[model samples]
Target chain A: MKRNNDNIKYDSKVISIRNLKKAFDDFEVLKGVDVDLYQGENLVVLGRSGTGKSVLIKIISGLLRADEGTVNVLGQEITNITIKNLDRLRLKIGFSFQNSALYDSMTVKENLEFPLRRHVKNLSTKEVNQNIEMILEAVGLSQAINQMPSELSGGQRKRIGIARTLILKPEIMLYDEPTAGLDPITCIDINNLINEVQERFHTSAIIITHDLTCAKATGDRVVMLLDGRFKYEGTFEDVFKQTDDEMVQRFHDYNFIE
Target chain B: MKEKTKSKFFLSKKIDKVFIKLNDIWLFVFRFFKEVFVPPYEFKEIVNQCFELGVRSLPLISLTGFIIGIVFTNQSRPSLESFGATSWLPALMSIAIIRAMAPLVTALIASGRVASKIGAEIGSMKVSEQIEALEVSAINPFKYLVVSRIVATTLMVPALTLYTALVALLGAFVNVYQFEGTSFTSFFVQVFEAITFLDVFSSVIKSFIFGFTIGVVGCYKGYTSSRGTEGVGKAANTSVVTAMFLIFIEELLSLQIINALRIVD
Candidate 1:
């Protein structure tokens, strides 16, 4: 596997998880999982449905606390930090949920401007409008600025979700199933956009998805989560070569190569 | 023996459930106070909620108040005439409308309208993960969603009650003129004589308490909503029911306080 060393430096761990475990009621979702993310690297977590991929990201972002062990994000342990400090740390991390989760009450412009107006106060109207235009342009949705989330198509909503997160200029990005319910073409478009975002912003990202196209298109390294832990870790080529595990082999076989 | 054990288990479970609910509401109220006084007040959301809870509710409350005044006056007229105290009609009607009917009716109406709406909106937001989105953005969802809503209801309910009182008195005047040929001037004179500072103050205080109850209960139900789309409906239903119950409890307490203070005859 070829490593991109351009943005790497000493102390390259942007996020580190050690023996993380989480359970909902009696169901154990994550049982002693461990992972690390380096600076400016796109790490894709591949898992089937209900394998705790989204849970892992939520734990890292402090949206959900782990049952045991530790999650270190940006050199701060998130498991035991105060809510005020967690909120402060959250500003540096942008999370795009699976459903795009746009504020249905607001127009696209308002939704995109929400984070900017909240975090960066005293910004002039001109600056706010400029930032909104720039981010919408990046996502190719400048025309839909005045539209509401309900008015947008599924793919458009996803792009708008990505645009809203990107407007914050976060150092770390966590995308949970960014292309879960889109057409193949739209999925490809989103995958390409993900790669472009990583390259342009130099952000370290952890993309949680089961889509092989997305993983191949954007991931520098891939990890397959199974039975509450990372069962496989390698490049896309290395993962495809593994046939010993039935689940991993099924994932490989299910992908329609173009 | 098995039946006895089962009954005991059920009773304990019921008690535990009630205590859990009380604890949840208490914590929700604490969080509201803590977040409401903090910085970054959501002024725009508060204004929006005021518009929704106050302005939008005017027509329904006005109609309800008018009907209540007409019915109440018509019902009380025969009894007063039997005692040769027909002149006391306006005063009795005014006191009833101002002290109890206006606040209780307006609160129940708002509990059905505003409380249900807040519960459903917030519950749907939770179901769709919009609340989580707000949290991930580092914005305080409780302050933005709950505090502004509670503050708006707390302020607007009294305003609505005052408006209801005016409309109800007007209805009473119309009803009186139809039956007894009492002039508007005489009727209003009797009403003004009957009303006191204590009556208005007590009514306003009760409305404020009822409004706070509706807001807090609605927000609590919605904030803790789970189980997907079905949960949204359940939250809306439970919010209205719980808020109306609390309004009655507040009314009872207010009456006791008024009697203690000799504010009512």
Candidate 2:
């Protein structure tokens, strides 16, 4: 598989999350989870609902603090960084929200411009508009620029979310439930867009979703979460050939329904 | 025998849920302070929120101000006339308004309208996981959400109070003429003679504080909201009530301070 970043060697790792733990009250959601995201690779985190999949990704992105352990992203230790430094680190990573958390009151243009305006310094208004137009076209949302988020469909909203993330042009992208609420055709559309983003922008991505089609289409590696730990982590073939795991077999079997 | 066990199990589960929710809210509050100054400032979003939360809510504040001014004038006119102090209407009314009524009443209305609206909007966003989405994006939710809201309230509330005072004075003018056939210039002369600069300045400054308190407390409660729809309702309800209480307390404290200054003089 061609990696997203040509500047870095395929074997080099970009994100190293070691022994991460997070607990809400008495219930521990993640118990010593460790994962490494290689340069340019699309890693799909698959899990049942409430199995801490979102929490795991959140810790890596510096959104949620891990109860213990380390998250080193792009060679920086995120856990111990100062507030100012942490923000600088964040600008290098883009996140597409699960429910397309576009600012409801903002127009599509404003949503796309939100990060670009904040992080990009000395950028002319013309340059900003060009970037927005390019990202919007990439997400197939040129027509929806003036529209409010409430005016978009579920799939269109997700694409806008993706567009918003891409406007930052970060080294890494985190997608939380990017295809959760879309139809199959729409899911395919999103999957194609994700692949296109990886191919064109060469940005490393980690998608958190249980959609098997999404796993097969966009993921270079599938990591399943069960009981707050990774049950399986491997390529699609590695998962498909295995007969020992019932959940893997069930997912593989269900893939034929399409 | 099994029935008793089941009921006890359900009771324990309910209690456990409440404790966990309370725990989450406490943790979020602690986290809010920690993340407040972190960079990647959500400038565009904050400005947009300010326009929504502050500017858009101005109409309601003005309406309340207008009504209060008219009602105060109408009610106080006959009583002052009995003491042959009818000409003191503008002075007395202006003092009543600039000193106490405008800020007090505007804050109370804002507690009902803007505070509750903020609570429900933020509460819904929290439950829907939008706030979590913001966090995972490496954005500091506290600075993005709370600070923007507080700043908006601090700026808007005083402006709203000022507008309310102006509108109310106009309403008082209408009331005076309708009742006593007094011209507008005479009313102003009487009002100007009665109301000290201290009264206007004190009232305006107090309204600013009231605005800040309402916005901060309303956003705080909403940001920490839990328990689904029921929690959202509770947050909105408490935001208004707390703001109303704070406005009253602030007014009383300012009054005491003013009295102290008068006594010293």
Candidate 3:
């Protein structure tokens, strides 16, 4: 597997996870995993199902505590930070869940409005509406402003989820399986959207996905997580060249077959 | 010897599980109180929850109250008539309804309806990672979701109980007029004479306690739910069961305290 060469230099580290370990019951999900996220880079963590990709991002976000090791997000050690500080840090990080996770009781407009109203309390109705309009237009779902999550299709729901997270203009974005369970065309659309978001917002992101196409489209660096630690870290082209590795070969063969 | 060891191990595991659950719920309660008093109170959410808990529950509460009143009067009438104490019907029925039946019945209904609703809603959110989404968005789910529902239930349950008592008394009036041709005015007077400030106060207190219990248990079950969709269903079911159990326990304790206080007086 390819590794990061010493020739490259990152501008500044936005997130640094060192010797992270997490276990539920007797099952260890992350075993001394370490990674660094630099500014304005999309670091795609590509792993097969059940590889604890989501767990790693959750630990970085401070949603789940690590049993061992330290996670520094925006230069703040998340493990020891107070809840108030964690919350302030969270306001700068947006998470787009795989299932969209929209409030089922609310309309699309209300779902988009929720974060703004909570964090940016002084925003007036007109400003909020304009913000919502801009995001909905960016996601190309301005027509669905009044619709409920249940009424929307899978692709629409994913777009709305992205829109909701982007409304706050978070400095860091964590997307958990952004294109999972979608048709090939829809998957491409979501991948393109991810690229567009990266360019538009200039936000560093950690995208957890098994889709190689997504990694190629959005990742400046693709890291393959295997056995609870990163086994490969390089460009998407470097990943394609590592066909001698069994797991990487298998992933390429399976994904490239179509 | 091996069998005995196995049994002991299982017993200890069960005990550990119960204690862990107790500790989790206790911590949840403390966190709720702490967050409730913090700044940025969610008045809009609370108002919305109140409307849902109080206004939407009116029909069911009214129906249960009326039926309970009629059934209770019918059941108690022959016994009173046998003792030639038919004239004491309104007083006895009012005392029973105000002191125990109304609060207990209303709480049970609220537990079934509101607790299950809260549990299912929050559990589904937990399953779908919406709670985590809120956390990531800098929104305090406990304050926005749990506290609002708890406060709403606390305020609305007593209001519902009062309405239930009134409907029950009206139902009792219907039964009384049908049997003895007694005027509504006399039945009202009799009921008012029997119901003291203590009865009203105790019923309100019990309802408040029941409401708080329902809110807390429901939110706890939902917030901690695991195993995905099936866990949501389990959370809803367990919420109703636990809320009902707690309501009965609260009622029993309140009754004992009221009796002890009366004896002292």
Better of 2 and 3 by TM-score: 3
Query: Relative to the true structure, how large is the alpha-carbon lDDT of every model?
Result: 0.90, 0.80, 0.89
Q: TM-score of predicted model 1?
A: 0.93
TM-score of each: 0.93, 0.86, 0.93
The predictions' CA RMSDs to the true structure, in order, are: 4.1, 5.4, 4.4
Per-residue lDDT tens digits for candidate 1, residues B1-265, read: 0111232454579797898778888999998988888888899989999999899999999899999999999999999999988778999999999999999999999999999999999999999999999999998899999999999999999999999999999999989999889999999999989998889999999898999998998898899999999999999999999999989988999899998887435
Candidate 1 Cα outliers beyond 4 Å, as residue runs: A1-11, B1-11, B181-183, B263-265
Candidate 3 on A93-152: residue-level lDDT in tens? 889899998889999999999888887978889999999999999988999999999999
Superposed model 2: Cα runs more than 4 Å off:
A1-9, A251-258, B1-58, B133-139, B227-233
Docking class of 2: acceptable
DockQ per candidate: 0.43, 0.29, 0.50
Index of the highest-DockQ prediction: 3
Per-residue lDDT value at A94 in model 3:
85
lDDT of 2 by residue, A169-211 (tens): 8889899888897899999899889988988888888999888
RMSD from true fold, candidate 2: 5.4
Evaluate model 1 with DockQ and give the value: 0.43
Ranking according to lDDT, highest score first = 1, 3, 2
lDDT of 2 by residue, B30-66 (tens): 6545654555455665677668766787777667777
lDDT per residue for candidate 1 within A1-258, as digits (tens), equals: 223536644368899999999887667899999999998888999999999999999999888888899899998999899988999999889899999999999999999888998899899999999999999998888999999999999999999998989998999999999889999999988988887777777889999999998888888889999999997898888876864788888887898755
**Cα-based lDDT at residue A158, candidate 2:** 93
